[model samples]
Target: MSIAASSDAARATRRPVNANGVPIHTTSFIGTNWTNRTAESPPPPEPGSYYPMAFLVEQPPGSVVQSHFHAADQFQVVVAGGGHLGRHAVRPVTVHYTNAHTAYGPITAGEAGLHYFTLRNGYDPGARYVPQEAAALKAVPGRTPWQTTTAPVEPGPVIEGPARMEEMLEPRADGLGAWRHILPPHAALTGPDPAQGMGQFWVVTGGRLDGMPPLSLIFVNPQDAARTAMAGAEGAECLILQYPRRAADA
Candidate 1:
């Protein structure tokens, strides 16, 4: 499926805020069948804080995602057919939660990919997700690379290479940071080394995997980094959600 763009007509059609003080805005990207019960916004972090959580979701078949990692803790869950997780030996571990900070990839060899979602604890401007600096935490050796071109835009160092890991940081705000990952067939992605941040939470959104039932969800605590990975079989795709922590004053 093509990535949906925010349209001027859709923006013009935004409804006015109701009596509940919610800002009116057009919603897209989120699945059409899903309901929008709340407003979405970007977070504004103070100067230094640390909140970390994440969600992993599964998407429809035939999706593709480039290899990448973030500077926060991460997590994932299998929502569809079995896939591979990193370069390790392929196993039939379906619908299980894995921690952030370790490398993982799809396990299956077919065309079907696993869909999952993750949420990390990070900064947010009001209800909007944002990124901020942590306390005096030193960057993980060779792991804190940053990037600015991706969605949920932030101003951190850009990460490079296929063998890099994510860095952990403290949150400067209070709220949840959200992101989505689309993994394609026959692809491989690794996680940031755990010693960098906190942990993560994940959820599955679509597709079907071997060991995991449809729509299954799980959490990847900080200690389980070595066990996370996904692999797609024939004609499968996965959507993973990630939430990072935020500070109380953000």
Candidate 2:
């Protein structure tokens, strides 16, 4: 569903908590906890930020996720702890992009456990287990020649204050890309225009980004009318996502 553009949208913040302000229930990701905000369709239709669905997964120590792929594209960030994304070490704030049907993982979390935020631009296509196939195709988990792009797997330098935008991925249509917004109190941002068939999403990583204040994960579908400008409630920082336009409609 496309999030209609809003010339006047109110920012609403939904923490990863429940109606009582406690964190919400989570689904199991292998042996981990998956806290999803937009795993389903749009609702709580007040303060949509960027994409339609997103989740936070906490992987336990020694956790191993089998090699798998999804029918849809994904953008995952390592928020805390340390782990191996395939063989690449993933630490806090490492932003990773994966194309449709791209294979990844065998993620082994560090002692402190690995925590990451996962976002999806399109529908949840679920997971396809393919440990054997994934292993056969991999020379390197994230840098496979055919499945990889030149995008940085790690996050770029943090830009603070003044409300700056960093185009982590070149603008394209379809799928997903990476972006970050660093804002001081009362600052605002408009996501870069997406290529046709492409959409954007905004998620607050540090402080609060909202149409109103403390907006957490808000979806911004292609033409969402609910809200336009994202403002920092305080010393806020955010990660923006763009679904890269693809060919063959793939």
Superposed model 2: Cα runs more than 4 Å off: 1-51, 132-161, 172-176, 195-197, 211-215, 225-227, 248-250
Assess every candidate by TM-score.
0.31, 0.65
TM-score of candidate 1 on Cα atoms, chains taken together: 0.31
- Which lDDT tens digits does candidate 2 get at residues 152-210? 33433334436666666655444455766677666666665544435565656666555
Q: Local distance difference test, per candidate?
A: 0.31, 0.54
Q: Number of the top candidate by lDDT? A: 2
Judging by TM-score against the true structure, name the best candidate: 2
lDDT of 1 by residue, 199-246 (tens): 433332323222233333343434455224452442112333333332
Name the runs in model 1 displaced over 4 angstroms: 1-40, 44-49, 60-64, 88-110, 122-250
